[model samples]
Target: MGAADARLPVLEGGPLLRKAFPDHWSFLLGELALYSLLVLILTGVWLTLFFTPEMREVVYTGPYAPLRGVRMSAAFDSTLRISFDVRGGLLMRQAHHWAALVFVAAIGVHLLRIFFTGAFRRPRELNWVIGLTLFVVTLAEGFAGYSLPDDLLSGTGLRIAQGIMTSIPVVGTYVAFLVFGGAFPGHDIITRLYPVHILLLPGALIALLTVHLILVFHLKHTQWRGPGHTVRNAVGKPFFPQFTASSGGLSVAVAGVLVLLSALAQVNPVWNYGPYRPDLVSTGSQPDWYVGFLEGALRLVPAWETHVAGHTLMWNVLLPAVVLPALLFAVLYAYPFVEQRITGEWRDEQHFCDRPRERPVRTGLGVAGTVWYGVLLLAGGNDVIAQTFRISVNALTWVLRVALIVAPVLAFVVTRWLCRALTEAERHRLAEGVSTGEIRQNVTGGYESDHEPVTSFRPGAPRRQLTAARTGTPSRTPHEPEHPDR
Candidate 1:
């Protein structure tokens, strides 16, 4: 290594190996996303080998007795064959599906962590945009993959998608035609989506993921405020052995969890749903969890239309399906810039993470958005919920609609208030020090409790220590100063 480095001046590995990374659990969320994507790629390749994406009619003569001699699409037939005949094919398929779900979820949570902690400020804004783009691309990839089996549930989902596409004002029909190749349930959709799912989307994801990681390395990580930590210096484990070993173990653990889930939990049972029939609709048919918010939006919106100059405008479909998602993503993409503009903190780069309490408005906004999404997600399953609980679906819808508007406002106010309260409490703690749990008798028979001076208090140390103390192992003695250098 020394000889190679001496011969090739650019081959030096010391600086790269010595790079520091913060040791925090929240930082692992991004790693979870990356590792799950790896699992997805591996299992996707395995499933791709046995799967046929063609939509031509074929007889299901596989080992499954119930569907024997049933006429189905080649796509569905191949799916059955993979599930029943190919060794370990079912496991791979489930693992791929589970990994995809986990990948989307991990990216979402990682983005939330970034947002709430102010990690998306300043120099990291572009990376935030890239992260959002990754999320959007992954969603498209998932929907495409979900439809590849050409089963009844997927067919229903495609039907809704077709309706959504055709609801656009001027170009809706053309877009739908271009996507399905002619009309609804056209023969070419599966074949078309196959390449996109396997090739195009994955390629885009890999490229984006690579660039995201490069920026992370170049920009360095944001760290919490602590003793000996600063915007200019990162404090934690080095990349060579410490961070690398822990990260490798994490990757293995993610893979193992995915495998376990695949082995035990069945997902997307295409066989039960049967082949796609244009006229048939399955009961309680639902999309994957990530797609549920859109479904919920479609359900919650009222069916309203307008006629203008002999043209019909679909306010219901367009508002919920098209405009809502566009607005949501646009806000997400532009949030960092918007916040920078509002706070006038564009010139100085933020390397230290902000506590959620420190930025009450941002935290409240985050909570409000989350509540809105959660309500929509619940609304998506309104029918099932109504049926199970023996309630009126219309009534339930009305309640959710009201909540869709009111819940967010309430949540924002509550969250903002709580953040302020926590901030005030922290200030008091800083001023008075932590309670030492001891009382003494004064000379005049008055009783008072003694308090230890917090000589070495770090800005954010109290929150961390309080959290640790809740877990029953206080990191420091109450009698000792929280920090030796206040």
Candidate 2:
């Protein structure tokens, strides 16, 4: 046999090679995340060559004149060198940061598509859980990267993080000591986080991504229900030529876009923030965008704390920093099962997806959660927003605080109503075609409007009946005999 024939799957005739992948644009969201992650990995490897993840004190004498004689962490010093001294190092750094942002955002939108479509139901629950775990780890990985630069803003964040850790009632302080390698701004936090940011977390993320792709390949993808689409069959492009080109081209395009963004837009200039000094504070410092939600939550939380039996409980820190995220992630991890429980549709296989209009409850839930998180994220930037809009920071905080309470409730109610309304309207349109903007005069000389049924939906005939009629086939019902002449 020739080389091509020899590589064939024995007697299977390359059956697995032609696996179908749904061609919908929504599917690109997952590919966007994968491509962004690839960018992160590539730029991260480059960064590792110059990054010094040590917290040793050093006097800066680098090219950046702002902190010429100031003492800073070695990690921060290296960051400055990477920005100013190393050629293209700043570009790569920004590329990696931007890639991380897109990665999380793509994952978030992908989850929305999967959830609203009921694609996570039956045989896909495990994949959903795996995706959730990946999200948690991705968030942690971003946080680790954010902290590695050892700038003032990141150090302040670390201090706040230590406070949250110590608020765990009993074991919090011990956990903080163990993780921090000692007390606040411990001697070796950057060294500790280096392995996690560059090695451990990335390793876990890649391994999980492998398993996720394997499962997706094995289980096949879910497509919308339509002609020739069902539990056993999907309608889409093949894997070899069309899908490969489209997905690969899109990934490369996204990487190029990130490169352009990095070149044009400066991000996270650590030199400007200076080194992490426990006593010094910058007025307008802010964390990365992904970390903004937590910052907002922390700001919105009421100032409350308690002490029981000498164990202090910082409720303010605990609620927003610890309890809130924990609860939200718990809900996220359990959402597929929760939806299944509520709907009571325990089918083993689902090859078709539900339109958003068909799943009002799930759609409403998604909208509510998105609104709540978005409000929190905006709250994180309230300081900047207030200054820009010339409003009081305190006033903006209160507005977002009230929004945090009322927005989700309002979003849920409004979304449910809208979905139900749209669904009913769609049903009507399906039964009776849209207005043709034509009117006719009756015998009595009064104008009467006329309605037309869609071509496929002939009043009494729905899709099922229409298909049977066109195919000249009868369904499970007995049909009256047609005359031989007819």
Which candidate number would show the highest lDDT if scored against the true structure?
1
TM-score of each: 0.91, 0.90
Candidate 2's C-alpha lDDT? 0.82
lDDT scores of the candidates, listed in order: 0.88, 0.82
403: Cα error in model 1, Å: 0.5
Please give the lDDT score at residue 193 for candidate 1. Answer: 98
Runs off by more than 4 Å, candidate 2: 1-14, 433-486
lDDT per residue for candidate 1 within 1-486, as digits (tens), equals 345546765446546666799999999999999999999999999888999999899888888888899899999999998899999999999999999999999999999999998899888999999999999999999999999999999999999999999889988999999999997888899999999999999999999999999999889999886555656778889886899999999999999999999999999998889899999988899899999999999999899999878667898999999999999999999899988877876766878787788788999999999999999999999999999999999999999999999999999999999988887787677667555789999999999987755443444467545444335444333432221111
Please report the TM-score between candidate 2 and the true structure: 0.90
Assess candidate 1 and give its TM-score to the true structure: 0.91
After aligning candidate 2 to the native by TM-score, how far in Å is the CA of 37 from where it should be? 0.8
Residue-level error in angstroms, candidate 1, position 464: 11
lDDT of 2 by residue, 64-154 (tens): 8889999988999999999999999899999999999999989888988898887898889999999988888999999999999999988
